[model samples]
Target: MLHNFAGNIEMYGILDAIASGPIEALTSENSTMVGVGMSMEGIEQNPIVYDLMSEMAFQHKKVDVKAWIELYIARRYGRSSPLIRDAWNILYHTVYNCTDEAYEKNRDVIVAFPDVNPSLISSPLEMYPHYGKPTSRRAILREKKNAYEQPHLWYSTSEVIKALELFIASGKELSASNTYGYDLVDLTRQSLAKYANELFLKIIDAYKFKDVDKVTSLSQKFLDLVEDMDTLLACHDGFLLGPWLESAKQLAQNEEEEKQFEWNARTQITMWFDNTEEEASLLRDYGNKYWSGLLRDYYGPRAAVYFKILIESVENGEDFRLHKWRREWIKLTNNWQSSRKLFQVKSSGNAVSISRSLYNKYLRSES
Candidate 1:
């Protein structure tokens, strides 16, 4: 049997749930086995969640959390230092320190569909359909306010920047460690992901004011950052979407089977299910990812379509056509989901170098 405590971020409470069992249910003749599992919703981008889970397992089995962290640092970098520990402590208190009421993981604006006026909608229909009366719109809007976690930053971005700085400072000592390299890239990725949300808000503001030049320029920078992020993630095998889809194909014996499996794999992460005119797949983008090829191809194109339409509307003196944009967006998403294009499965580039370059390019202080 599996126990699900994945929604809330209460680590200790989850551990307690894992450790506790039904009374009068255990005996020498019958044993109960429980497993702890994490959702893949954002796991690829948040490796620290795995680390947290491992810490939970160790704590549940009579190991101290502090000792586990120390050992983890040692094994992760083949050595530990005040710099590393200090950096990790900041991370523990900030990004890793989710409140009990917070979502399982933080969400990113990149995964959210672009809106001229951003508000979390209850149903896809309300956003796309104009036939609904004001009363019906009000009802639909209130329907799913808390259905799932919305995109939010629970911690300070400055603190995350400090953690990234510490990681970069320790690079000379841990450069040769693959685990350290992964952590470096992952930390940088996290830092920039948070910053991307800021950029997105700016984009929304520019769109709101109908600043054609500012919108055009900001959109380029946003897409460029997405491309750079994809490149950085492609440096690690764990961050590639290619191997994921390729593995699905490899499992098939025949070409027809391979095509089916590949389609299924793509669909699972993209639409979740087919969307219809009257109903939008509420689960669409629930599996939104930060994987390499996916960012460049899928998410990037979707945002590009949004910007293109927005800019055209401003130039042509037309109202932003929500339904038309949604139709175009769906077509773009479906084309990607159904395409047979294969992405590179193997990783390339140097993680440390890429991280440093990005730090200088995006995060370094000008003063």
Candidate 2:
């Protein structure tokens, strides 16, 4: 909710703009009240953004977004200062500003399989055999390029970093505010995760040059960054994967039902659909999470396998066995889905302290 405020507002703004012409075309005789169909609720798992949207929707007249943001700050934090204003203002224009056609959500590259040239195949007829036409397959690939594979950031990274710094600086004033702490951890998590993508891109470039030493170093850094991200998320219950899995299990009336439901939840985030060696699931890693336990336990090991294969190929001067690698990776994924390992449902550690530790470790150098 706090993380995706910009995307929620973007949907509102886009609909509002589209309705403007139709609204103006109506004459004095036309008594039709055309309200844009906007949903104030989402599956964000946090209500702060939804609460703000609900307030805006309750207004019987046109809403001023800027004014609403101020009210939100006051209502959410119980008080406001220039530091808080500056931070949120930066967020409003940068990270939270989603006027472009790029993905509405931030891309988590840590879970994505590593490749020398990481992208959706332009010609995925073989990859998506279900699609008959080449053009149709290409269209799917294009959409996936923006939404899933190789996601791009629409905002300036430096501006968001500055905003995070300001957000952390306001901690002294917002110490007692629990909401502030949540946002702090979320902002920190996003900033670091974005950097992980940058690291991934660098690793790809290193692999291209066959620089084994650089690849080795960058791969370790990438893994370490993911481990730290898992640590940050573990501090907040909102970001854990445990409760979501547990809830899925608890909904079952019998053991068989429990197993099926658990499988469904696990498969959605991982494979998404059944696939064989002849046909692969293009939606793999599409529903990846930045949740605790998921990072260290799942995504990290998967990436490690890819890195190991990449290093071996680079050193041996042999071509990458894409087919063999895919088979092994899919097997690993399938095995994890069947395992009955229970994750920690409750959160631990202080959000503010962990965020500060991460900021000092990761973002301080950038500042």
- For residues 119-192, write the lDDT of model 2, one tens digit per residue: 32222223333321112323444555532254345566567778888888888889688777767777888788
Q: List the residue pairs that clash in candidate 1.
A: none
The residue-by-residue lDDT of candidate 1 on 100-140, one tens digit each, is 44334335657655443232322323222322111232333
In model 1, the Cα lDDT at residue 191 comes to 75
User: How accurate locally, in lDDT, is each candidate?
Assistant: 0.65, 0.66
User: What value does the lDDT take at residue 190 in candidate 2?
Assistant: 73
Off by over 4 Å in 2: 1-42, 45-49, 103-106, 114-148
- Shift of residue 364 alpha carbon in model 1, Å: 3.0
Q: After superposition, how far is residue 364 of candidate 2 from its true place, in Å?
A: 2.7
Judging by TM-score against the true structure, name the best candidate: 2
